[model samples]
Target: MNLALWIAAGLLAAVALAGGITKTFVPKEKLARANGGGWTATASVGFVKTLGVLEILAAVGLILPAVLGIAPALVPVTAVCWVLLMIGAMITHLRHNEAKFIVLNLFYLALAAFVAWGRLGPEPF
Candidate 1:
């Protein structure tokens, strides 16, 4: 169970990092064109960039505290934050009628929730 939690956290960290980097660096127009979606269009540049920064911070929080054996409790806390982020993402995607996207977001949400539960309960490290 501990190993499973680590694997899930690692996967989430990788995804969040990639998403953060893309959202932070890519031009808004380019992203819209690349994805051809209303999700980004519905949000302001500042808002998207802010989300990106938060995601990056969350990604770091998911790994660093636990790995370094310092303030390990932060792992579950960070997972909770990821859950909130995914919930918001799902809501936004649903508003855009992007059911397919919501499916992926839900998967991410579930993984984050699992990590939160595992780290807080059985897999404290």
Candidate 2:
């Protein structure tokens, strides 16, 4: 369990950092291709940027508490929140005909769910 959590935390941190960096640097036009719906809505740039910020924060929350053994509960909370957000992202992709991103969203969502379950779900032999 410890190993799983640590690996997941690393993945989470790397993913968040990479995404945050991308959002912070990439031009909006380029983002459109990687994003859902080809970034049709003008608000998408802001939306994704904000989401990136949130993800980075959540990733930090997941690692800081547990890694430092300060407040471990926060890790599960962050995972839960990330799962919810990914669900919303999946919906957004479907609504916008951005099928490409849906798979990646689902992958992230599943990974988040795994983290949540590993942290909070019942033990299974």
Candidate 3:
């Protein structure tokens, strides 16, 4: 269970880091164009960037606190945050009728929820 939680957290961190970097640095218009006017098309640039920063912070919180043995409780908290973020992503994708993105969001949400459940229940670091 511990190994599973670590793997899930690591994968989630990698995905969040990549997404954060892209959303933080890429222009919103370009992102929208690339996605064929998906949710990014309707979202404000500031909102998008803020979400990216939050993702980056969540990724860090998922790993660093547990690894450093400092406030390890934050790992589960971050996982919970990721779950919420993915829920929001799913809602936004659904609003845009983007079925594919919603699937991906669901996948991420599952991983985040698994991490949260494990850390908070049987696999505390």
Task: Please provide, for model 2 over 1-125, each residue's C-alpha lDDT reduced to its tens digit, 9 standing for 90 to 100.
Answer: 86776787678767877887677667666776565425434546777678778877877986888767788888888888888988987887787777878998888888888888888865211
Worst 10 residues of 1 by lDDT: 33-42
lDDT of residue 65 for candidate 3: 99
Residue pairs that clash (backbone atoms under 3 angstroms), model 2: none
What lDDT score goes with residue 73 in model 1?
Answer: 94
Q: How close is each model in CA RMSD to the real structure? A: 0.8, 3.1, 0.7
Per-residue lDDT of candidate 3, residues 7-107 (tens digit): 99999999999999889999999999999999999999999999999989988999999999999999999999999999999999899999999999999
> By TM-score, is 1 or 3 better?
3
Top TM-score model: 3
Among residues 3 or more apart in sequence or in different chains, the pairs in candidate 1 whose N, CA or C atoms overlap within 3 Å are none
Full candidate order by lDDT, most accurate first: 3, 1, 2
Candidate 1 local distance difference test against the native: 0.91
Q: Which residue segments of model 1 deviate by more than 4 Å?
A: none
- Alpha-carbon lDDT, every model: 0.91, 0.76, 0.94
TM-score of each: 0.97, 0.80, 0.97
